[model samples]
Target: MKNMTLERITEVCGGVYYGSEADKKKEIAGAVIDSRQVESGYLFIAVKGEKVDGHQFIPQVFEKGALAVLSEQELSEPAGPYIRVESTLGAMKKLAAYYRRSLDIKVVGITGSVGKTSTKEMIASVLSQKYNVLKTEGNFNNEIGLPLTIFKIREQHEVAVLEMGISEFGEMHRLAEMAYPDICVITNIGLCHLENLLTRDGILKAKTESFEHLTPEGTAVLNGDDDKLCEKKMVNGKPAVFYGIGKEAKLAKTEQGEKYLAEKEVYATDVEPVGLDGTKAVIHIGAESFAVTIPIAGEHNVYNALAAVCVAGKLGLSVDEMKRGIESVKTIGGRSNLIHKGGMTIIDDCYNANPVSMKASIDVLAAAPGRKIAVLGDMGELGENEQELHAMVGEHFEGKGIDALFAAGALSENLAQAVGKCSKETEVHYFKTKDELMEELLPYVKSGDTVLVKASHFMGFPEVVGQLTK
Candidate 1:
């Protein structure tokens, strides 16, 4: 919004301007693809999707007081002014990249195989204690979503905690170019997005593409416990900041080319999981330490907290500030958010899942008091080894003292069989569809029972959580 005048937009996007000269120098209030989000003076970008074409809403957006529209197709005698580009999405990315260069904001670009959203929230919470922070909202971390998130940054925001997600190789590179992060954080290179990436190493290489766009003075914050990440000593001529739990001692010995020296280590100790309450830990950075409690209900959240500590430390925040930020952080829905309704406690982690996250959620459910039930579904984009991955998650539930397992989706049938073979006493139920599972879910769950609903986004397990919570 700084220098985003109509003339500047046309120049940056290389689009042909088709409107009055009076509006050429006018700066837009905001930009959006959705016509419903269009406000007075906002720029509407017309994108053609599979189900709907945004061009159809151009007339409606102008009536709603939109200042200008970015279109890929020609309009006949349209309202207001418009710019015609070869591709609206490509134009939007160019606009976002230009806008990012105009801002004096410190961006924390977060990406990994998993835990991207949770880590973004943690970093934002910690940074907000000292700076006016703008973080990515919801699952808007893709190419389109990342640009939209960048467009939301304003003059008042001091820092932008952007979550960069990808399923392919060059996607992160494009996102990172627009973000131009001052600090890059890779959560962990787990078994995710294997459909396109094929393997963990492939996933690591793809996720680290964000580093290519890191500013010269940028720092890389990595998870030391992760074998793939711990080996990274330096990035962009700057030593990486490594954080983890139970891996601090090894950090110093981790080989860095010819030298065996640790980068900057921020590790946690005395990690105590408080059942559904969350996790308590002592975070150490250099000679200082802070005793903190994360009220988000999972041991995996400790990694998220550690990532936050590493970032906050780099940003010159005090231990007390980090502790308060870590403690005050609240869970977003579908990422281990705790919900109480209909006489039952539901862990609605149904937003998305990989084998690692699925097992992590199971650990949370296993630790809860009373009857522990796991309602799981298929994990998408796992490539050819998807069955083995699903079965691996099922094996994690074995001997965890889980009361019952309700698995939906075809891939989860492998999960059901694996859990049954390993944990003979655990009641395993397989449903062909989530609707069928939902019908039986309510009857199986009793008062005071703790239920964990989890699956990949495509599984639509939120509806199952909805039924139970209702």
Candidate 2:
């Protein structure tokens, strides 16, 4: 809220200030878009959303002790103060960008096809060991969410780990303009948002747009193991720092089908999976290396830890601090969170899914002690090859030695059919709706069974997780 007085805000937003001259010097305590979140000294930005226009709540927010409101329309009636702009959403972005430059903070902007949220958490955890870190909460990684996350940063916060998510092209560019991160991290390029971004190469291009907004002296931390990412040897006029599972990664392929090799600056070695307990590995940072026990499950998380280490190294965190940070990180509710209830082990990764993540969750379920039961639903935004992608997941799950597969949603029928055609040991059941799948789920599972629930956000798989846990 520093340097965010009404006069400064009006100038930053290119809006006309309509208030007494004395009130212009007053600074806002915070900024918010929701009328319900307005406080005594808060600035309410009135956004005309698809369902409800925020202009209707402008009077209500002012009644709730809001200091001022940002509106796209002129207000003639009684209000403490108001800044009238052309567009509230656009003004909010400008306000956030100005406020960000006023603060002396180091930002780590994280983006990828998948794992953006989890990786942001990891980087925030590691940076918190040496700095007061503030990170993006939940799935607040989109156009509106990114600016809101930036506004949450205060003078008390030294480092901000921001998660930037995008479905189409140029979204990252707009997001990164406000962020201007000192350290930019890309988790990996995978089969996600294929509806808008057609292929892996297109995804790589869209995700790397964050690099354009990096500070002149900024650094990029990339996943070296990804062949698409490994192709980029330099970013922002310097060598891009790479992190991965091994010392060297297979670079882009040549015309003759051969691959070049490049060494990773920050890499993990001797990665040993500890089942549901998480993973144990050795992280090598520069000439120094140390042992770490990542509390989060899945081998994919190791790359997240390495990215955290790479960012921490750039910020000058010591080895012991990085190790403790890696070990101390906890699982998010819908992303790789583990639960034990009703004599069953449930992997509650139902927040969202793609083919890569679905197969990764299957690998986790396959490691459990009891019968592996996969309860899957449809994955959205797969573009024209949606059926083929669903079938691809089915094919990957077929040979995993999974005991039974209970799949729902119309798209998942492809998965069920694929599993039915190849696997004689596995039982495949398909349902037209989640309601039907839930009806049969409880009666089918026995005690000591390990179940994996996964799907895209639109499938509402969290409800499935709740029913299973209950």
Candidate 3:
């Protein structure tokens, strides 16, 4: 909200200023798209969504003391000031990009097929040890959401950690334009969004677009363990910093600790303790060694923490600060988050799911203390191998010491059938809808049971999680 005057905003957005010259120089307190959140001197963006057209609420926003409105259509009602553009969404993105340029903060951009949000949280937590950091909230990693996250930045923030998620080609390009990060981290490329990005290579290409707008001297933190990501030649002629369990990586893992070579600047093999509760790893950067402990589950999180530690070290955070920050990082909602209520442990990971993440969640459930019950839903946008992938997850459930499985959606029916083929004693049930699943699951679940709820966002599995918790 600092130095966000109407005149400055107009200059930043390159918007046509059409209103009172007196008010043009007046500063805006904030920017918002929803009319209900508009405050005095706030700039409102009239977004035309599927269900509602924000232009209809322009007059209402003005009545609520909005300083100006960005709209595609000129309003019939008299408003204080308005910036007319072809698309309010595009204008909002442009203004956010311009606003980001004004900040002196160091931006860390994260992208991948899986673990982007987790890595963003890890990096933010690590950076927060030494700086006042602002990070992307919940699933706000898309084109529209990315701009909104950028707008949340205020004067006190010394660093910004942003998650860039893309389902199609060129989406990351737009997201990167808004971030222009000083450092970029790619978690790993996997089988996701295959409906549009037909192959893993296609996904890799889409996710790597974050480097397009990165600063010239920006560092690219990569996963050396991932087969698809490790074959990179060069990024803008600068070698990427590779961190994984492999010996060839710049940051490799060894028994003593992580090793880093000066010539390669590689992190070598190290003795890192990873558990279902968290990960404790020693990262050797040059002669100094930093130990980090992250408060998230899964072995994948260890790599996420390692990537964050690498970036934090580059930013000049001390060993103690890095350790404290990594330890302080907590799981984001609906993302490998463990919640206990009604004497039942619910792994509320219903935000989204894929083949890679599904297996990971199953591992987490296996590590839990009580009986493991998996409530899974369909994974969307997996182009050609959708059924096969679902069946594969079912196979994992069969052999992974799972007590029971409840699935939803047409795709999930394949999962249930697949699991039933392998283990008749392992209970597998399929639901056509969330309501049906919720109705049937209550009697099956008991106190002290560990339940894992997982699915793609469209599957609406979170509703079932809410039902279980309630």
Candidate 4:
């Protein structure tokens, strides 16, 4: 929002100004796509959506004191002032990229098959200790969303921790071009968006596109434990800072086996899982060591902590500051948020699903101290073998000490069948719809049971979580 005048915006977006000469030099307070949020001196981007067209509300926005509108359609009669561009959406992105370059700030761009948002939250929490940080809110990690997020950055923000998610190739390239990150974090290349990416190797190629737009001296942080991510030798001629757990982690071994370690890499040693409460581990960054308790479950979170520690160290956060920051980290809704109600514990991980994330949530559900109930749904975008991938998750449920399984959607039936085949004693039920599952879910749930509700966002499993909590 700084140094943003109507004249500069018109030049940055490559639009012809059709407004009054007096308004050309006027500065805008902010920019938005939605007309309803328009205020005095605001710029409205007329985005065409499936349900409602933003152009139709231009008159209303201007009446409410909007300074100008970026429009694709030609207006017969002027409403205050407007800029004409070939495509409003394209102009919005171009404007965002221009604004990002105009600011003097460090950006940490995060992307992966899973845990992009969670890792972003962790890194932002850690970095907030020393800097005035600005982070992406909710699921704004795509082309349109990333630009909107960039527009939120004020001059006061010293660091921008952004999450970039892509379904196929070229998406990350466009997002990276806008962010032009100084630090790149690739959580892990896992099985996600396989319908577009094809395989894990394809995922790696798609995810690493963040390196394309990274600064010349940018640092690449990666997950070394992953077989595919470990193959990377260097990014932009700079050694990558790889963080992970287990023997494969370079820092724990104290000797770089592959020469992939950056000037600094991190690892967690003497790991101890404290049931569902969290994990206590000694995080090692280069030669320095700090013992901290990650207030989140799953071994996967230990990797998140290490990733945050990597960023915090680069930002000059001391061991004590990082420790307090990690302790302050909290879970986001529908992404491993632990809720307790009706004398039962619920793991609300139903925001989205894939083979890797489903298994990770199951690992967390396994630690519940009571009867383990897994309510899973179909994982979308798994390519042609989506059923097999769903069944693979079911296989993890069987013989893994799961007490019951409630599955919905067509693909979830495969999961139920596989779990039933594996665990004869574990109660397994398949529903054609979530409505049917909702009807019978309460009857089967007993007091002191640990219930995990998870599925792809399209599956609408959050409704089931709502029913249980109600």
Candidate 5:
């Protein structure tokens, strides 16, 4: 809320301030776009969303004791201070950018085709050891959400871990403009947003834009195993810090076997063990190490831990602090959340999915001790290669030792068929509707089976996750 006075906000956003001249210097306690969350002295930004227009609730927010309002449409002689902008969302971003500048906190911005959220959680956990930290909540990594996350920063926070997600060109630039992060972490460049970015090279271009507003002295931490990210020349003329299981990485894994790595600096190859009930890992970073166990699954989580360790080390957090913070990290709602119910274990990863993540989830399912049943739905926004990608996912299921596969959505039919052709041992079923699929699955799933449900957000596969847990 620092430097969020009406006069300063108006100056930053270049809006026509239409209110009492005496209230120009009045301060706002907070900013919100949702009327339900509005509080006294809060500035309500009237954003015209797809489902609901925020302007419709302006009067309600004013009644709730809002100090000011930002509107796209003009009001007929407003009662109190208000700012009229051509676009309320744009103005909100501008105001947020200005507010972000007022804080002396270090902002660590993370982005990638996959694992951004998990990596954000890991980084925030490690940094929270020594500092008061605020991180991106839920899927609030988009333009609107990023601004709102910035608005959540309080005076007590010493560092802000902001996750930046983009599906098209120019989105990251806009997000970075508001964040201006002190440290930028690119989890990896993978086949996501191909609808907008077109190719992996395109993905790299879009994901790396986080460096656009980075401070000159800021660091760009990248996945050394990713061919695209590893080839980057420089970020703001500073060499990129790479971490991965490969030899070229500054923080590479050295331990033997599938799970444990023994090398020095934040290696995922170290023995980071997770029980069937939850996640557990011990990470080594530059003359320091800590054992952290979380309530999440998948080997990919180790990389998330590595990214966090690198960021925390850069911020000067001690080894013990990192250990405690990582151990305290909990499972996020939709991302890789493990729900146990009725003698079955459900890996509810229905938040979102890509080819990379789909395969990773399969790996976790393959590791489970009981009969593994994968309920997969359509993965959206993959451009012209959608069919091939869906088939590739199906092939992964075919090769894995999964007991059964239930696929929903138009694209997933191809997946089911692909699995059927490749593997006779696995039973593949496809459904056009979620109701149809659930009807069939509910009767087949045994008490001892382990179910993994995953798809993009649009597929609404969380319904399957909910049913399994219930």
Candidate 6:
């Protein structure tokens, strides 16, 4: 809330300030766009969303003790203080960007095809060991969401881990402009947003846009295991920190090799998976090595942990701090979070799915020690070969030792059929809708089965998980 006041907001956003000239200097306690969230001393911005025009709630917010309002249209002799701007959302973003620059904190901006949220959580968890941290909450990682997330950063916060998500080229540039990150982290470039970014290389180019906005001395933490990302030696002229898992024999061959060389790097060896309990791994940083148990399952999470360690090391965290941080890191819900209910284990990873993430979740399901039942839904924005992609996912299920496959939505029908053609051992069922799937889901799921529910967010796969868990 520092430098956030009626006067400061007007100056930052270039708005026409009206009424209570004396109140201009009064600091607004908070900023919001929704009238229902209005609190005492809050500044409410009237954004005209697709379904709702927030201007209708301007009077309501003022009545609820809001200090001022940002109006997209000029009010006719307004009774309360207001700032009239062409667009409220635009002004809100500008104000947030200005406010971000005013703060003396290191912002670690996270982006990639997968694991943006989980990696943000991991990095924030690790950085919290030595600093007062504020991370992006919920789905607040887009243009509007990113600014709203930035508004939550107060004076006490020493580090801000902001996750930046984009579906196209310009989106990341816009997000990066507001975030102005000190350390930009790319988890990996995968086949996501192929509707716009047509290829994995295109995804990489769009994601790395965050690096262009990094501080002059900023660092890039990359996943060295990703083929697309591993080759990059520098970003925006600054050398990046590369981390990955490699054979122990290769660790000693650091003889001026370009692939092995990095500005700073960390890798893992002796990675031992302990099923649902989590993973035990020995992380190596130069000569220093330590064994740590990451409190999460999946080999992919090992990379997530190493990425956190790389960032932590860059920020001056000691080995013990990194160990504690990695151990303290928790799995985020809908991003491979494991849940046990009614004698069944549900891998509630139905948040978002790409070809890469879908396969990763199946790999997690493959590791479970029970009859594996996968409930898959449609993956969105996959471009021209959407059906082919769904079939590819089914091909993954084929002979993978899956006991049952329940697919819902239009695209997933292809998945069920693909599995059917490939194997008779796996039972495949298809549903036209989530409701239809729910009707027959319970009977197919046995008590001892491991259910993996996953799909893109639009498919409403969580409703299916809800039915199974209920």
Please tell me which predicted candidate would have the highest lDDT against the true structure: 1
List model 5 lDDT by residue over 137-228, tens digit each. 98899999999999999999999999999999999999999998999999888778899999888888888877888976899888766667
Which tens-of-lDDT digit does each residue in 1-470 have in candidate 6?
78787888898888999988799999888888878888999989899999999988887888899999899888876658999998887888898889899999999999989989988888998999999999999889998999989988999999999999999988999999999999988998877789999988888888888878998889999987676776677788877788878632132232234343232368888898887668899998866888999888888888888888888887888889889998988776787888888999999999999888898888778778889888899999999999999998888876578888888999998889989988677888899998888778888777888999999999988777788788
lDDT of 1 at 135: 98
The stretch of ten residues in a row with the least summed lDDT in candidate 5 is: 254-263
Candidate 3 lDDT tens digits, 202-282: 998888888789888887888877666666647888888777653453554533466542222334345443535765666
Better of 1 and 3 by TM-score: 1
For all candidates, the clash counts are 1, 0, 15, 0, 7, 0
TM-score, model 4 to reference: 0.96
Q: What is the C-alpha local distance difference test score of each model? A: 0.91, 0.90, 0.82, 0.89, 0.83, 0.86
lDDT-wise, the better of 3 and 5 is: 5
lDDT (C-alpha) at residue 432 in model 2: 93
Per-model TM values vs. the true structure: 0.96, 0.97, 0.91, 0.96, 0.93, 0.94
Compute the lDDT for candidate 1: 0.91
List runs of model 6 lying over 4 Å from the truth.
Answer: 247-264
Candidate 1 positional error at 436, Å: 2.2
Model 4, span 131-208: residue lDDT tens: 999999999999899999999899999999999999988999999999999999999888889999998889988898
Among the numbered candidates, top TM-score falls to 2
Off by over 4 Å in 2: 251-258
Model 2's C-alpha root-mean-square deviation from the true structure amounts to 1.5
What is the Å distance of residue 358 in model 5 from its true position? 0.1
Score residue 262 of candidate 6 by CA lDDT. Answer: 34
- How accurate locally is residue 281 in candidate 6, as Cα lDDT from 0 to 100? 94
By lDDT rank, best first, the candidates go 1, 2, 4, 6, 5, 3
